[model samples]
Target: MDIKQRNQNAIDLTFQNVTVTVQTKQGKKLLLQDVSGICKSSQITAILGSSGAGKTTLLNVLTNRIQNSKKVQVNGKIQANSTEINFRKFSEFGAYVMQDDVLLETMTVRECLQFAANLKVQGDQHEKDKVVQETLKILKLERCQNTLIGGQFVKKGISGGERKRTSIGFELVTNPSVIILDEPTSGLDSFTAYLLISELKRYAINKEKTVVFTIHSPSSDIWQLFDRVMLLIEGQFIYQGKGNQSILNYFSNQGFNCPRLQNPADYLMSIMHQNNKNAQNYPIYFQKYDSLLKPYVEKEIEQGEKFEILSYKFETSFVYQIQQIAKRSLNNVKRNPILFRARIIQAIIMGLIVGLIYFKSEGRSQVVFFKLIVQILIYLSKDGSNHPTSIRDMNDRNGLLFFVCINQLMMSLKPCSVSFPSMRKVFIREDNSKLYSPYAYFFGRLIIEIIPQIISPILYGLIQFYMVGLNDRTVGNVFFYFLCLILNSLLGLSLGYIGGSIFSDVKTAVFMSPLIFVPNALFGGFFKNRKNLASWIRWIEYLFPIKYSFNAIAANEYENTHFIPSPTELLNLEFSKWECVYILLGFIIGLLTISCFCLVCNRKRQQ
Candidate 1:
C-alpha cells in the first residue's frame, strides 16, 4: 500500500482521559492521572519529562506493553486510524524500541542489518542485500559493518552509540510509519548524541515518519531537532506544544524570568523541581498549565490535520524469516571452522575413551562396561561429547545436537527447563512479520540438529562396541545399541529445545536439563530392575527412552554368554529387540510432538 493511501485522517492516535494507578509500598499511586493526547504522522512528537515523570509508562501504554492493574484503571479511548488499538494489536502499526540494546552479539553489524532486512522484505537476495546496505549507510555504521555486536562474553562490535543506531536500523528496514524510541540518545557523548538526533530529524523530515521518544534533559542542539515537545510531571501532562517555545512560554506566564545565556534543558530541570526553595509557587501551576494546553491539542484533533499519514503496507513472509534465520545459522557455522572441528575432535576423543576402556574384558565385566558405554552415550546425548573441554563449554555450544536431542526432549516432557528464554525475542520478531508458522521453526530446528546429535553418540557406541570385541554372533546386538544411543540423543534434543523455548536464559535452561534427565535415568533401569523398583517408578520407566535403550543394549551383550542360552533366546526377555526399538522410537516421537506443541503455545503467548 502507498503511504498516502494508508494515511487516513481517522484519528491516528488518541488518549481519552486515561488514568493509570499503580499500587506501591506507599499506597495506591496514580502514575498517570486522566492523561490525554493525540499523535499524528505529519508531526514528530517528543514525550519530554524528568525522571519518574511516567513518560516511559505513557509510552508503554501507547505500545500496549503494560497491562492495567486493578488500581491502575485506563478509563479512556485509544484510537489509531479510527480503530481502537489495544495492547495486543498496537505493535502491528508501530515500532517501539526500549532504552536497552538487545542485538545478538555473535552477528556482525552487516549480518544484523541483513537478517532484519530479510525478515521484513520480500524479494530476491539482491534486493534484500541492497536494502540492508542502504540502511547501514543511513545509520553511519558502514565503517564497522564487519564488527560483532554485544553479549556477556563478547564485545567485538563498534561503540555503544553505533549499537543504538543498529537497533534503529533494524526497525527502519520494516519502514513503519510510527517509530517510538525510549531515550535514543542515552549513554552517548554530547557530540555523538547530537549527531544521532540530527540523523533522526533528517529521517523524520525526509521520510515523513512520526518519531516519538522520551529523553532526559537534551542539549540545545538536540532540542532544536524536535518538531514538537511534551512536558510530563509526575505522570501528568503539563504541556505539549512547539519545541523550546513551549518551555519558555510556560515559565513566562508563571512570572518566572528566563536566565540569560543558560541552556533551556537545565532551566527546565531547575523549574521542574518540586522541593527546590527557588521553585515557583504560581496558583495551581500544574492544573492551570494543563487547562491552557488542552484547547490547542483538541483543536489539532478536530481540524482533521492530526491523524492523516501515509499508509505503507510492507508484507513480511514466513519463508523469509525462516530462510533468514536458517541462512544466518548456517553461515555462522560455516565461517567458524572451530565449531565443527571441535565436534569432530569430540567424536574422536569419545571413540578412543570408550574403545580403550572396554578393550578386553570378559563376560560379566564386558557386559558391565557395555552398559557403561550406553550410559555415556545417554550423557553425550545432552551435550554430544566426552571431552572435558566440551563438557566445560557445553552451554555455549549451539548445534542441531542441542536443538533436537537435548533441548527438544526436555521441552516436550518437562517443558519448564529445556527451551531458550530468548525464544521470546524470536517469537516477537516473527509474529510482527507474520512470517513462518511456529511448527516450521520447531521442525526445522529438529531436522537440522538430528545429524549432529545422532552421529557422535552412534560413532562412540559402535567404535567402543567393536573395539571391546563383542561376539561375532552379536553384531546385530551392537547395531541395536547404536540405534538406542541415537534414539536417546533425539529424545534429549527434543527435550532441550522445548526447555530452551520455555526458559530463554541459558542458566535456567541448563539448570532444568537434569530435572528432566533424572526421571529418565532412574526409570531407564539404572539403579534397580523395573519390576523391583517402586510401582510408580516402573510406570514412569515405561515412558523413559533409557529403559528401552538399556534393555536392548543389555540383551544384545548378554544374550550369547555361556551363562545364558543363545542370542536368540536372550532376545526373548520380557521385551524383545523390536519392542525396545519401537518404545525408543515412540519416546522420541512423543517428546518431539510435545516440544512442537510448546513452541506453538509460546508463540501465541508472545502475540
Candidate 2:
C-alpha cells in the first residue's frame, strides 16, 4: 500500500562542529566533542553507539531540549535545509519521539492517536479521523487499536512494541517533515524490533520524511534497514557513510575484521574509537575516518540547507486545542478505574470515618467546679491560647466543625500532588511537541481535573455534615458548607500542583510535603488560636489556606446559633462569616495563579 501523504515538507538537517560541556562536581566535562553530521531527506539514518556515546545528547540538542545553563556550554551551528537555524525555530518543523513511552496508560491505542490527531491535525473531525486511521494502519497498530497503553507496574495493556508504535503514531498525525527518535527499538524482542524499524524505514522512503534515531544494538535485519549509519564512540563520530559493504571495508582496514558467522551489527558496535585513558586515540580515529568515510558525506555536507520555515503552520485554533486536551483528559479519567470509581469510594469511606467519630455534639453537666478546674489548668499552662472559649460544649462542637475543614483541605492536597508528577512529564512532552499552547494545556487540565476537585470534597462533606449534626442544618447553610469544601479542595489541588511542579521527582515532593503542611496545620487556628499565635508567626496563618477555610467553616456553623456553652467559650470569632468565605476564595484564586506559574516553570525546566 502507498502509505505516503503529500505536504511532507522535506528538510535536510546538518550540524557543524557541535560540542557540549557540562559542569560536574569533578569539573567541566565534555559531553559531545565537535560532532558534525548530515541527515538527508527520505533516508533512514541510524545513530549507532553503545552507552555514553552522545547519541541521545546530539538528538536532544537538535530538538531544543538541551538546557541553556551557564553550567552547561553548547557551541555549534545547526542548519535545516541548508539555512543556519537555532533549535527553537528548527523544532517547529520536526517531530521528536522521546525514548520513554510517555502515553497515558489508561487511554486505548486508538484514543491515544485520536487525541494526538485532534491537537495536531488541523482539520475537521472527518479529516482528523482519516489521519488517525491511516496512521494506525501505516504503523501496524490496528491489531492493538483498542488495547490500553499501560504503565510499568499497573494496569496491563499493549505490548512494548505497540506502545512504541503508538508513540510514533502520535507524531505521524501531525505529518511532520523531520522525525527524530531516541532508542525506538529499546526493550523490544528481535521480531518486534525489526517490524518497528521496518515501518520507520517505510515512512522515511515512502513519505519523504527525514528519519533519524539512536539505537544501542540492532539485529542484522534491523541494521540492513538503515540507509545511512553514523557510528559514535564517547562523543565523536567514527564513521559516516552508506549502511552497506563500504562500512565493512572501512572497518576491516582499521585492524577490525568481521568473521563470517558474526553479526555485522555486533562487529560494528565493537569498533570503538578510543577505549582507555592511556591510549587516547580519538585523533587517530578522526584521521582514519577522514581518509576513509569523510569523502562519502562531503558532497552531502557541502549542500547548503535552505529552510522554508513558513511551510510549517499551526492549523488548529487555540480553543480547539483546549477542547481536544480536555476531551482526552476526561477520557483518561474515565478509562482509569482507580481514578473513576476508587476515588469516589475513598471519599465515602473518609466521610463515614469523620461522621462516625464526631457523630454528635454532647455536653457535660458539671458547671462551677469544672470551670474552676479548667481555669487552673489554663493559668498553669505557659502556652495557653489567650482567646476565651465559647460555651465549653459549643467550643467542642465548633472544634469538630473546624476538623471538617482541616480534613477536607488535607484530603485535597494528596490528590493533585501525588498525581501531578506522574502526569507532568506527559504534559511537558506534549507541549514540547507543539501540540498546543502551554496556556491551553494549563486551562484544559484544570477544566478536566476540576470535576474531581468539586466532587470528592462535596461527597465527603455532605455525609460528614449531616451525620455529625452541626448547628447549621438548614439548606442554605449546607450549600455554603459545600461551597467551602469545593474552594478548600481547589486550594489543596493547587498546592499539590505547586509542590509537584516545583520538585522534579515524587520523593522530593513526598519528603517536602509534610514540612510545609505541618506548619499550616499548626497555625491553621484549630490547634492554636489565631489571636494568641506569636505576632511574627501569625503571618503564616494568613499564607496557609487552612486558616481561612477553618475560619469560614467555623463562622458559618457557629454564627447566630444558640448552643450549650454559647458560641465563644474560649475561641474568638472576629472575622464575619462572609469575610472568611471571601478570604478562602481569594486564597484559592491565589493558589491557582501560583500553581500555573509553577507549571510554566516546570515546562521551562523541561526545555
In terms of TM-score, the best-performing candidate is: 2
**Which segments of candidate 1 are over 4 A away from where they belong?**
1-11, 69-75, 274-283, 304-320, 334-351, 363-419, 422-437, 471-478, 558-573, 603-607
> Model 1: per-residue lDDT, tens digit, 1-607?
5755544522256666777787777888888878778776656677877788898888877776666556555566676655677654555557777787677666788888787667656578799899888888878999989988746535455789889998888777666667788998899888988887887777776666668888887888887777788778787777777887666877788776678677777787676665556334523556676678888777765553444333444545656545656665565445543434555456567667655754543321233344655644543221111211222222121111122233223323333233346445645555544445666566554554455666666655556554554433433554665665677656666666667766657677778778767776656554555557666545666766666665665554444344423332422335865787887787668777877776677653221
Candidate number with greatest lDDT = 2
Report, for all candidates in order, the number of backbone clashes: 45, 16
What tens digits encode model 2's per-residue C-alpha lDDT throughout 396-433? 66667677666666676766676667777888778787
Q: To one decimal, what is the Cα RMSD in angstroms of model 1 from the true structure?
A: 7.9
Residue 130, candidate 2: how far off, in angstroms?
1.4
Give TM per candidate: 0.82, 0.88
lDDT of each: 0.62, 0.75
Tell me how candidate 1 scores on lDDT.
0.62
